[model samples]
Target: MNAQEILDECAALYTLPGPPKDFGERTVSDRFEPAAVPTLITNATIWTGNNNGTEVIHGGEIFLEGGLIKYVGDRVPSHFTTNNRVRSINAQLAWVTPAIVDMHSHLGVDSAPNLAGSADTNSMKALIQPWLRSLDGIDTHDESYPLSISGGIATALILPGSADAIGGQAFIIKLRDTKDRTPLSRVLEPPYSLLNGTRVDPTIPPRWRHMKHATGENPSTWYQGTRYNEARKLKLEQDAYCAKAQAHQWTGLPAQIPKNLKWEALVDVLRGRVKVNCHIYETTDFTSMVGLTNEFEFSIAAFHHAHEAYLVPETIKKVWGGVTPGVAVFATNARYKREAYRGTEFAPKILHEHGIPIAVKSDHSILDSRFLLISSKFAALRKALKGGLQGEIGQWYKAVAEGKIPLVVDVAKADHIATLLELKAEVDEYTGKSLRLTLTHATEAHLLAKQIAAAGPDVGVVLRPARQYPTVWDQKRVLPGPPLSAQSSVGVLTDANVTVAIGIEEGWQARNTRFDLAWAALEANGTLSRTEALAMGSSNLETLLGLEPQTDLVAYRGGDVFDLSSRVAAIISPARGFVDLI
Candidate 1:
């Protein structure tokens, strides 16, 4: 190899990852749309996501021009206002906040409608393929982009699925569609080295690269191999390759730096240039991964779906480089698998009290990224409730006289009451039996909460849709939340000591995450604060995913973001360099 080429390769290996030198001074964003128009939004209540996400500005204004946030305060400067080309929007005291960021998502790769060929989230070719990129699998036609954007998700860290130990490299992307309509156009701060393969321009600082790693049940069940040992062997092989190249062992007339695409990404991870996001659950898995990081002298950015993270804060704090890996988890999604059997709703609060950063995630297709905010709301709800709920599944059925369907509301209410009583009787009968029970879609469960609680603490109830609606004959007596009823079913069940958790019924309901959270807080009767609600959808997710600050903003018209009266008005995205009116 030429002397200059070898020197460049060695130098790039040691280079660290960060933003460009002109990051803050740039007038236009890298993702800016050429057709974007300058926009000014005035008279809004802005949640700037500053001051640890507590900063709010009343009667504020924001100036967006050339895809950058030029001014954010009480007034726009006269110079910007006088520009004839700028468009103005009166938010009319609406709430404006940073657009939501889903840290752990598989939106495009997983794709919606669930077809066989569309599933590209995992590659089963090998258990330890780090060179595979999620970007390559992204389907531009994925139906979730606009849906996620409608839910205020501007940016997402598209991660590979957990089917492999070292699944592949992950990439961050803006959710907005670009004119080019290609996956590459949507990438945010793509690694410069990606353009020229192994050759990078030495002048520009390296951008942060992300990778997905999984341990515990997923890899064990999928590949039937000892994941930790295999991962360790790969790291050793990478170390040898990098060491040989750095030491200039190859001397020839025409030669290239030693490179193995399979292990190259892993080598960068050892050099501390890649942010490793892991999929782990049990405490044992966490300990193994922590030991791996310390032994290899690398760092994990965050642990995704870490149901047991709250149980071992000290162990997480002991990670390499003294940086505790952020814990990203679901708010109440648990117990469907053995690995998450001990998962609790109070995990976020417990971890927070231990000085550990926490974030709530959707896991995309698993929980629907559009409703990612609901996870945060439930997290906050658990914190406020102080670990008072429990139970898994419970069922009740009643026999009615054939063809004796009642049309009257009073008759239906009476029948509903009778069915609930019968269900409670069955619950009592199995109180101490060797059976686990969970009540799903318990629309009228609140009516017999005392009876259900009396049965046992092991019986849990799951409330779907957050709010109850009388969409069918069985749900005729569903408790209407808010003004009609002082408290929602969630409140009644909590008061009666029934373990309750909120969930969505279908994929379409995911877009209503903000409304679900607002309704949950409203039904709580002031126990859940607006700031806490906002964190469930914004800062909390960012912390959990170990992501950089988001620059996209969403404007809600008429009232605060949590208010049902408010509606999304426009989206100001610095990442996409444009203002979009919804």
Candidate 2:
């Protein structure tokens, strides 16, 4: 469809973006057809993707039929196995789990091989083009599909690239390769989000940034980015637009002027029906975005590429008006861009401590889709190191609270300062870093870290199978120079707390090689346990993506079943035919 016609149709879709037509105007619900057959798998190891707390059945049995999982546990009902048509397989040596789900990707949109012609990642005509749908521009023929599916990726949330501030809508899709033909057959959900790009670029000259999809746009700019009041002023104008949109709710009255597509999209966010998976990083953006969302009474589903999330734990915990967005971070990547250079790998740990769930994305080719699990492992490693630091603080605070150390309340006490310094010295040495601590800092930095660590976990994470793709830059790189130190920390994000799932940010770029990433996670280092790493690649991802209660399973051979090159044995579907993984 031509741009003009597309806009006209979108404008006429005045009823607003809703769920599947059969479901009415309720919420986004699963619309997948279940597997058609009833099958029993006996004596298998099952991983339920709940990383904060594990639910593993060492010798489990399950019944899957009609697409959904009817049961999963240590034993399957006898009646299920008795049915003649119900196939039974002894999967004692194999592990059965849900298919991996990619949270962020540009699979069909960007297409594979990255040619300019198929490079339809953004609707760059203007900064606030929420009506633009990634669904409208997808190419199923992108070779990324079959490869990604074999790598154990079943579902994805595909999105437009981030060039303009408000790029377009994100769409959800199932990774079923039908020779890349027929868009409707592959789509699982569309309008996953009405993309809201933060930090609109003033760098793009006004002449090149005017609206092109509609007529009568000769004079005014979509965003007036004057030299003096550029970012903040422009942001304020955005807030005003959001306010207008939120208040422009429809009552279907004849007197009511039909709200335009842009306003309606913003209204969906404000009403919390749709999530704004925003593109953001810097601490400043986090603070400002939170305030803006609070002002408009909306919530961010997540903040994409939140590189500096560790800097504002308290700010994130404030929870102004609605639920704060999860911090979608790069796994082990940092220091590439000035704004992204700051935060530590432990940002996920820190954010979790502040009551924010974490979501890790590959950012596709930037961090390589295969590294999604690899990144989560690094986050886990960072969390372990931070926990060690907190352990030291906890010991020190115990002495102080127990009155072992005199509570000196006044004037500069040299001994007290020196004592705290000594304690911090031990912590820095143990955790391997220099933390700029002061008496004026919050207790979390001092005593609060001990307090919260003592209490429990802050937030569990969601598994999205995309990442920022690994990169090593000089100026933009994070501190503590050794690259291994950054990548090798792959164990326990605080024993039985913190969650993870897969989010594929750039599928086409990685050609959907998710299992390879899973292999990297498993073999990354000593920090990540075998089961934990496997979970990150498989079950943790499915659960995090909210695709649980599924009977679909992936079965593998070899003790090293999750190995990237060929761990996959078969893809078993109740309704669908078995697919070979290798």
Per-residue lDDT, model 1, residue 407, is 10
**What is the alpha-carbon lDDT of model 1 when measured against the actual structure?**
0.73
Which stretches of model 2 miss by more than 4 angstroms?
1-36, 81-83, 178-181, 189-257, 318-320, 371-582
RMSD of each: 21.6, 23.9
Task: Please give, for residues 1-582, the per-residue lDDT of candidate 2 as tens digits.
Answer: 133333332333223344334444332234434433477888898886667547777888888765557678778777656767798889853667677777677787777878887878776586657667777788877877777775567877776776655566676778774443577557664332222332122222111010111101221222231111232343354444434444553233233223544454554444344556766666766676566556555556666777776887667655445466566777567767676668577788888877888876655545445444533443333333345235676565444333233222111222233344444444456545443222221111211223323322311232222232223221122121124444321222323343433344355734444554454364344555657665755666444333454466777676355454446667777646655565
Q: What is the TM-score of each candidate against the true structure?
A: 0.63, 0.50
Candidate 2 TM-score, true structure as reference: 0.50
Residue 290 lDDT, candidate 1, scale 0-100: 86
Worst 10 residues of 2 by lDDT: 207-216
Question: What 10-residue stretch in candidate 1 is worst by lDDT?
Answer: 394-403
